[model samples]
Target: MSNTTGAERLRKRAQATALAVILSVAATSSLPSTNEGSKDMQNTGTTSPNASENLTDRQQAIVPIAAFAATGDIANLNTSLDHGLDAGITVTEAKEILVQVYAYAGFPRSLNALAELMKVLDMRKQRGIQDAAGRLPGSPIPTGDALLAAGTANQTRLSGGPVKGALLEFAPAIDVYLKTHLFGDIFERDNLDWQSRELATVSMLSALSGVDSQLQAHMRISMNVGLTANQLRQLGQVLADRVDGNVARRAQEALDRQLAIAPGP
Candidate 1:
């Protein structure tokens, strides 16, 4: 081949190899999002009782529990724990969720969130106030292929159906990585648990404007995780009341839809 042709071919091969490496690393990093987005449920501007009433003090605890655990907002997260502790969520549960989301959300958020939790824990200690404590053995889920399969099953449960993830088609191996890493490694950990994790996932998604599809899917999964409809209704309403400006409208809207489906206790 001519020198120009030979050089161009070599460049293409190098580019392909580089692409493969980058993709492989990404696969190992986090859970992949689905291409089909969650649809925004119709907004109804209601919670349960007032659907309009502000979250009661006890119910309000979910705010920080949801926020810190959801967005990794360190400051807000800390505040949430203090709020939860005062409201009775227990320091141990708050810390566990923060540590657990590291699996679903990522280390950066998880670590920052945990630091905030420790700070709160310290403050509580100084005052001789302790929230409910729980045990964390470190190893909750199994390792290797079993982990991957279990995570996939968990992810599917959250989605309410099978997820033929898109990233895999774009790059085949990535599918395996998500199943192994995001689904397997993280989901396997029992500390955060699936239901609570999805609650955080939905609340965090509500904080964000877009990603409506993912939010809805997680909402569906949240139900699957055993959250009562009233609790879900309470969740959105609390978000609307507390995290106003950006999420208020969306929160109110999500609450409305959930109220419809929520069972009457």
Candidate 2:
């Protein structure tokens, strides 16, 4: 009987030990996990308004390249060109961006920027970097009346309606040039899409002072081409990050003014 009683006591002790182990496991499970805390910290640390909507590496590289080219900062332009190529901007696209510089920054700056691109290419070639030559215009550009008609249509579509203003009325020749040459001849080239063209234009304008009116107009055109206001804000962020405070401030101000006049959906 004493042996049986001792056996029962041992069984009871085993049960009590098991219960204590189960309670310890329950208490441990009830406490917050370190991994969950780590996840929360990671999310909070990386979260930002523009984090998801930030510009791509190629687009970010274009910002400083265009800005420096517009402002005639050849040294910085050279560096940006190298960075742009490294970021996957093709040789043809780089040429196109610099070529379009003339429309806003003037012929001298455009020519200089193109020349700098040539130098950049030559150096890269020496270093055994065979940069991709992007595709040319897919279709033939029209001429004469056909060209004018196509350009006017492009301009109208880009402006979101008929672009009528005192400035165009005062200088009708400028209007023709804009429709035919700028929008028609250049824009007709399909190798570079309209979105990239507008991005280059806005970057150029943002780099220059006293062109807020044009800058603001392009900001609207930027939206008309399906670039979001958030993207433009991202552009400003790129400018601030890659270029300088003043250039970024100009872009942000122009964007703010444009959005104030027409809030994006």
Candidate 3:
């Protein structure tokens, strides 16, 4: 065996300890109990009082689009976008999901998916299909400090509290961006409810590789926001049927991990 320095072993142990603490905090704090989330779920308008019922047509339409977009399957994304429009998913709602996609999938994929959407819409118009140009958020978006404050609040609620972890502490800017931009600006926008947004997020994360921790976190967030475990399982089936089996497997693994940690209703 090669000699390993005492300092190197200590450093490795410290890193492992930090990761465990972060994962513990994330799992415990990011998800509210079902009873705790009920009121918020009702207010969001994304689900019925019984969230376990089958997802609505619009919700189903969004699942594959989100998965394909996150995985950079442009051709499949294009087909799903057209199907989404045909299934009564308004342009505004679809646009909101794509914008949210950028937060997880990054700017390049998000931008490309959006561009694909525009092309889909233009082609549909040529084919004489009039996809609904959905309404924008009626309220004005907050600016400057107010925007930051609103985002912080939104982030707290979604995460079940103010998020704190080793990685966030290492790069506080990322936490700020998550709160101010991802949770605050994008989440504040109307048309899509928090539940649907979380659903899209969870679906996207499930398709992406090597982000099991984030995927697991989103699974909790999905539940906290209103999706039932049964609904998420159905989403896995949707991914298998509509997208890739591997993506579905990834989603199932994340969900399983979440369930093992926190058995929910």
Candidate 4:
């Protein structure tokens, strides 16, 4: 009896010790390690300082659409158009973006892109997808001298001041055309905002080679029109994800150059 009692006591003690060890292990596992705790603190504090400024779905849709249109990549443009429309870009807004492509990518590319848009719309309609037709220009475009004045004002505002240079001096007619037609005629259309226009311009410029200077200039103009550097960085990411890496690299480099010259406040 004494031996049996002793053995029973030993068994109970061993079971109790086992239970205690299991509880201790569970408690230790529940709490984070020291390194893990520090990492958690850093992540919670500074993982994304500007997360709110990231580009919207609609804005990101514009990057690939514009880049594909500029490079005459009709197949990718088709996909981007479908995505953009699905992302809440109205029919008129899409049209306006393609129309603006001519100013940078030339008439043929613009025309082809517009035709592709038409096809996309038709196909979507057949599939019972009713896309919204966005609004038109709310005001009339200026004419003659008024047009020139308006364009000049716009150029000054967009360029951040009166634009004077040897290029303008040597090509006086081009200057007049730029002020009168491109700025006045195209920019005066209030349906699309300047920020969107600059987004399209930057994307279009980024896709084309031998236009590094223009791309960099538009990067500055993009900032002047209220696009944040974080948003532009997001643009580059969109290009990389949806468009092409080379295109994104060009855009990022242009943005970097602009930021180096004029860091945002």
Residue-wise C-alpha lDDT for candidate 3, range 1-265, written one tens digit per residue: 2346655754553444334323422121111112344334423423343434777777788899998888789999999999989887888878888877776678889899999999999999999998888766645667788878866676656555555666888877766676666655665665566666766877887787877777777776676666888888988998999998998999999889877766334
Please provide the root mean square deviation of candidate 2 (C-alpha atoms, Å): 25.3
lDDT of each: 0.54, 0.70, 0.70, 0.72
Worst 10 residues of 2 by lDDT: 25-34
Question: Which digits, one per residue and each the tens of the lDDT, describe model 2 over residues 70-118?
Answer: 8999999999999999998888888888888887778999999999999
What local lDDT does model 4 show for residue 47?
A: 18
Give the winner by TM-score: 2 or 3: 3
Which tens-of-lDDT digit does each residue in 1-265 have in candidate 4? Answer: 9989877865653343323222211000000111223233221211122246877788788899999999999999999999999998889889988988887778999999999999999999999999989776665788999989877776666655666555557767767877777767776776666666767888888898877767777776676656788999999999899888999999999889867756235
- Locate the minimum summed-lDDT window of 10 residues in model 3: 25-34
Estimate the TM-score of every prediction: 0.65, 0.78, 0.80, 0.80
The C-alpha stretches of model 2 lying farther than 4 A from their native spots are 1-52
List where candidate 3 sits over 4 angstroms from the true fold: 1-52, 263-265
For model 1, where is the 10-residue window of minimal lDDT?
38-47
Candidate 1: give its CA RMSD in angstroms.
Answer: 13.9
Instruction: Score candidate 1 by lDDT.
Output: 0.54
List pairs with backbone clashes in candidate 3. none
Clashing pairs in 2: none
TM-score sort, best first: 3, 4, 2, 1
Off by over 4 Å in 1: 1-60, 68-73, 100-106, 137-140, 254-265
